[model samples]
Target: MIASMWSLLAERRDFFAQLALEHLAISGVAIAVALVLGGLFGGLMAEHQRMAKPSLALVNFLYTIPSISLLGFLIPFSGVGNVTAVITLTMYALLPMVRATYTGLSNIDPTLIEAARGMGSTDGQTMRRVKLPLALPYVMSGIRSMATMTIALAGIASFIGAGGLGVAIYRGITTNNAAMTMDGSLLTALLALLVDMVLGFVERRVGMRGTEGRATNRRMAATFAAVVVVGALVGVVRALAPATSPAIRVATKPMTEQYVMGYMLKDLIEHDSGLTVELTEGVGGGTSNIEPAMESGEFDIYPEYTGTAWNAVLKKEGAYSEGLFDQLRQEYADRLGFEWLGMYGFNDTYGLVVRREVAERYGISSYSDLAHVAGQLRLGAEYDFFEREDGYRALCDDYGMSFGKTMDLDIGLKYQALAEGQIDAMVVFTTDGQLSTSDAVVLVDDRRFFSSYLCGNVVRSQVLEEHPELRQILSKLDDTITDEDMSAMNHAVEGEGREPEDVAREFLERKGLLQ
Candidate 1:
């Protein structure tokens, strides 16, 4: 285990660095924006007696909404990515800074303001020389809180394709790799600590220097000058840049959407034909990642589940099967100009997984047994499973079973909880490629509640015409992957600490998909 973890960490060192940088960038930008906006609002509230209660109440209300929920609500308008993540983080960070500013400014000595006025100072001069200087420490305190909040919120931003240490953690959880999870958590904590210390030192230094009264005005002028210069350079670059690229670009769902699909295909497509295939992996899970990219022409190829494409992509709602797959394929080809490239030889069906020991003790051999014992078992599942139209809620309603305990966990953590015996059962993907190695048993779905989730590639009709050979290569891989093969391949990347690209290449070569 130690050797495997070391190898995995060594392989992902660059990714970790990139994740750290992304986290810092997102957090820094959000905190900076919060500082300016929150600071200004706080100052205004401090001066105006009537605005204080309403403004404070508003910031406090925003602070109460869960970060992830807020991100989800923003998805329709903003779509997923760094933009949504940053905006949410910025809003979340505002409360602490605004509250601190309000408290700091409001608490400043009225005597100091009176003294400044008595010295023949104007109202603006009294604010600059007395109240503002007295409130510096309070402002710094708010900034510190804002910085911390930003760091915490940035971690959650990974779900929306905002790259950060959270992505690493989420990946680890989904794959049930404890080492990866620990690495991500440790790194995030370290980043937060480092930022706090640096900012703490700066805050102290600035507080000690005292407010220069004129420093804010000077800083504002410098900032305006910098923005003007930067804008001019950006305009010049845009004018000089070429408008077209010769390489064929392929867009795919983010990493979380279809897990390993795009990652698996990255090398296969690139090396097979020497084509410059651009892979755009969505960070958001299936629906959010696949639809927008496909509709926007941002992606040319993405793997979509038969069930998802049927119900989600095609807007056809009913029970699913291999037949639904063909129908959806034909529908998409005719209406959406998208081609279904056939199945990848395996169906990653959803099933109820129970600890082997628990199954043995109860003699629970099938879905019927689970229904009978449902009240005795604890269930663990991902958030979407509870809310999606055809998710766990529907399944449970059909079964007429209520779990004794239900734990909301990320897909990755569900496996861990089940393995640790913390949960009696969990929703699991059938072809996860790790079940064979784990001590869990998937119950037979006698009721056939789950739809077929055959793995396959889908591409834009135009891209297929341009790169017909690519389609043929990918088609040859259809239905060739068995459950064991997928599990093993997944293990190589998520378990053994190998790169997805390298694993995909080896699989293709071994299968003769690559010449």
Candidate 2:
């Protein structure tokens, strides 16, 4: 595993290097801010007996909020990017910093302070020359804790457009590639350890500065100053990087198919229209984030399913029926100001699947067929599949399925579970790339409980008004991809270890859509 990780690191050094830089930039800014503000507030609170308890309580309360929720709350203000990630992570670091500073300072011996006063030192002087120096170790401890956490959280920042190792991790999960996940995780872990070690060295050197000569202390301070300056420069550069010109921001939900579709859209739009397309794939919040982002012009376009927009967006009940597209188009335009574009000519809906051998043995060709044998089988499904309106409950109620046991598994791992016979059946997407590679057979939806999930580009209505030519260029994908085409493209990327952009470019070139 270590050898494989090293190989992966060597192969993707350039990509990983930039990701590491981004991670450093993010964590650096957050730690710097937390160190100053948190240390100051903590020190002040330690002296202010009346304010200490309430302020610490507030800091503790802030710390209790989940990282994801804090990130979501900041999205409206920071607008989804490195800035948001920095702000969220900075907030997370505050409590530890404050507590460490307070604890360290409060534990200082009062006799030393009295001696300083007896030597005619003022309160401020005593704090600076004696108390602060004594508290340096504790403050360093806080900084160390914040530094480690900042690095770890920076990986998750990729979900909100804060590019870091988390991007690699998400890409790996979406593609079901273990090597890629390990590549990102291992690097992030190593990076955290490096930061901790560096901080520890700084802490020890600073603590020993007084015992050493003035020259050594000056040299140590200079080294620390240089490090801080470099970190600040990286953060500034990342924050001020120029946006691509004439670019339409495109987003995608968290899945392999969405990523493939995102790449396809980027390729075709760039080829036909010569527009710079900024694609942000695998948006963590899915439609919940994408829908609001489109409405707010955070992004210009994304691929969305008709049924998902129908049920999740429209908040309507009942199974899908005909005229779903028309309703979605009209309602989106009227209510959400989004214009639905051409369909990809595929229905990527959910289906209950079992190993081909199991299906054949039980003569299960449809949902009705499975119902008779469901009691004898154990089922597995993605966690979200059990929560969707047309998910486990609706499926079971409609098909009268009563499995012996049911389990909610990670979507990425469900294929492996079913393949290993840990599950007799699983819920799968109709157009999943894995379907072609796996020996699983999707049962027919005899009761039609699930809705049609016809997919296509959804853009803000105003974006179309401005870039009228975009409609024509994007329409090139209309009725272009069949279920087989999508499945094959997915397989190429997810199974064959090919890049999504490569697969998309190949398809477009083969179709004469790219020059």
Candidate 3:
């Protein structure tokens, strides 16, 4: 176990370093942006009595919304990655700073303002000299609060593939591996604590400048300048470092195919060619990821589901045909500037899964059969399904079936909940490895409510045009995975407590997909 832990850490050293850097970058940027915006907004509100209540109320409301839900909502507009994470963190940081600024400015001595006015100081001068100076401490306090909030929020950004300590934590939780969870949580807490201490020290120093000597201020300034210079030099060197070799940039989505295939392709590509492979994991699921990354040239290659591309992306809702996958591939290339790298050997279709005993008792075998017994079963589904135009809600409506209860759970936790009898049924991916181990029966979609979810790679047109050999390499990976293979691989991570990357590598080696 110790050896395995060490190996995992060593393998992910660079990835975790990148994650830490990204976390810091996001938190720093968000705090800075929030400080500026909040100060301005607070100043305006303080100046106008009429605007105070409404402004505070609005910011306060935003502060109350859960950070994860806000991040998810922002995905469509900002897409995935650092931008979305930074923006969400910024918004979260805003309220504290705004309130602090308002309080500090409003509580400033009215006598000081009057004295400044008597001394012929204009409103602007009075504000600059009297209001700002007195409010500096409060503003710093707000900044401190924002910094704390941003650091905490940045960890959750990993869910959207923003990359940070949260990535490790989420991966651990999904795979049910306690050690990874502890490692990630510890690192994240330490990062937050260190940042808080640094910021607190800066705040204290700044607040004490009024009582301190000019010599002390001068020394502090010089120290800050020296640190900045050294940091800049280090950044320059890192940026100038040459690319060692050809690298494959694979784009993937969070918690889905991108999570699975990213690891699979990374080890395979690196081992086979002895070249670096960069993975750009995106935020959303299949329907949200594939085309946009391909069109924007943000990703070189990624896994895509044929059914999702057709029904969700193309808006072609109809019966599935044998040649539909090929037809969609050609259409996507012609219309969307992407190349459909031939299919991988698995179908990750939607399955309506229930406890085996329940299924046996009810004699439920298909969707049509589900209608008769629907009144007795409760349903658990993903949040997206509830909101989707043609998702589980619509499916139930179409079948004229009503569930006894409904609940929403994260995709990773759904299986555990089902096994624990939290819900009678759940909509799961057909290729999920847990089905074989758990006493769950996947009801046949005989009515064909779901579209084909055949897994495959989709490359940006430019990537396809630039590296023709990539097509050949990826094509060779086609029809390589099976239902059992997926189940086994999932079990290695989600069941047997193995890391996702390890499971991915082991599968590739077993299938001879890796050299």
Candidate 4:
């Protein structure tokens, strides 16, 4: 595994290097911003003793939120990618910095403050001459700690469509590539250690300076200023950078098929049209996160399912039908200013996947049949499935199912649980790779509880107006991918360890859609 990791790193050094730079830039900007704002706030808290309690309580509460949860909370406000990442990182970095400044300033000896005042030092002068110099070491300690922590936490940024080493980690896990995962994990650890060591050196110097002459203090201050200035410059340049031509910004959910399809859109659009495609794959929270982003024009294009777009994005209820496809498109256009185009000829609808042995024992071949035996079986499903409008409760209600027990499992773990006899049944998608080979039965949705989810591209209408050719380019995928085709491609990545792009390109080539 170590050998494999080394080879993968060497092979993808450029990719890893870009990710490392992105990781550094994100952490650097976040820490720099936190340092400025948190130091100001914390210093104020120290000066006004009454404000300290409430201020500390607020920061403590924010700091206590789980990283993933915090990112989810920030998505609607900050949108996704580096903006969301930097915001979340800055929030988490604030507590350490604020607390450190407050602690340092509050710990100053009263006699020293009095002595400075008696020596004709004004309040500001006393703070600069006595309080601040004495507090230097503590502030430096906080910066050091904040920098190290931010870099490590930055890995979570990739989960929300940000660029970083975390992308490698997330992609590696999704693709089942152990070497890629190792590469990302090891590099992140090394980065944290490296930053810690460098900061430790700076901290020791700050402590050693120890309230030196005014000239010496100014020099130390300049050193800190330089670091913050550089980080801020990096962020400004990135934010202001403009593309020479309008690029198609595409986003995709955190699923194998979506990743493959995202690349397919990129490949075909770039091949025929004189346009560049910027693809952000594996967006966290899928439609929930990406929908708002699309509505806000943060994303110009993304692949979405008809049913998921209806139930999840539109927040509609009741069973969907082929008749509603036009209604769905119309609602999207009139309400969201989006276009639903390029319906890929594959129905990746939901299903009730039962253990073959259990199904055979219960004589169950359909949802209605399962309902009769449900009281004796346990069902395990992904957590969000229970929360989704078209998910667990609705399906069960439609089929009159009453399982003996229900377990909320991770999406990745439900299949394993079913195979291990920990769950007699679990929800699945028609294009699930395991369905192609597993000795399990996908009970018929006799009641049509689940809607058919024909895959398609959801595009910003404004973009389509600018690039009318994109409509033709995107429609090339219509009637192209079949159920078996999508399942095989998904299995190629998740099961056979092939890259999603490689699988997508191969399928496109076979279909004569690409050269």
Per-residue lDDT for 379 in model 2?
Answer: 95
Candidate 3, residues 1-515, lDDT tens digits: the string is 56755666677788667767877877888988898999999999889979999999999999899987787688767776778888998889999999999999999888988999999999999998889989988888888777877787788777665777787777666566656666677667778889889878877766665545546867988998899789878988987898887677776654534466788878766766646788765344545644564566555677877777776677776644547877887888788877777577778777798888889999988888888888898899877777655577668877888888889887677878888999988898776756778788888877777766778887777865766667677777788888767767777767676666777777777877876
lDDT of 4 by residue, 1-515 (tens): 98889988898899899999999988988988999999999999999999999999999999999998989888878899899899999999999999999999999999999999998999999988799889988888888888888898899988899998898987776665778878998999899999989888766665554466546757978997998789778878987998666799999987789999999999999998889999998887788888899988889999999998888888999878778999999999998999988888999988888999998888999989989989999998766688899998887787788999999875545666787999999888889765666668888877778898999999999999999999998888999999999999988887787888889899889999997
Clash pairs, candidate 4, are none
Scored by CA lDDT, what does every candidate get? 0.75, 0.85, 0.76, 0.87
Instruction: Give the per-residue Cα lDDT of candidate 1 at 240.
Output: 86
How accurate locally is residue 489 in candidate 1, as Cα lDDT from 0 to 100? 78
For residue 254, model 2's alpha carbon misses the true position, in angstroms, by 1.8
User: Ten-residue segment with the worst summed lDDT in candidate 2?
Assistant: 205-214
Regions more than 4 Å wrong, model 1:
1-11, 118-120, 208-259, 272-282, 296-300, 333-337, 397-400, 460-477
Estimate the overall C-alpha local distance difference test score of candidate 1: 0.75
Instruction: Give, for candidate 1, the lowest lDDT window spanning 10 residues.
Output: 249-258
Q: Judge candidate 3 at residue 138 and give its lDDT.
A: 89
Candidate 4 local distance difference test against the native? 0.87
Which stretches of model 3 miss by more than 4 angstroms?
A: 1-17, 47-78, 116-129, 209-214, 232-247, 256-258, 271-276, 360-365, 387-390
Task: Please tell me which predicted candidate would have the highest lDDT against the true structure.
Answer: 4
TM-scores of the models, in the given order? 0.86, 0.90, 0.87, 0.90
Per-residue alpha-carbon lDDT of candidate 2 for residues 17-60, written as tens digits (9 for 90 to 100): 98888788788889989989999999998898689999999999
Which parts of model 2 have CA positions greater than 4 angstroms off?
Answer: 1-7, 50-54, 72-79, 210-244, 355-365, 372-378, 402-406
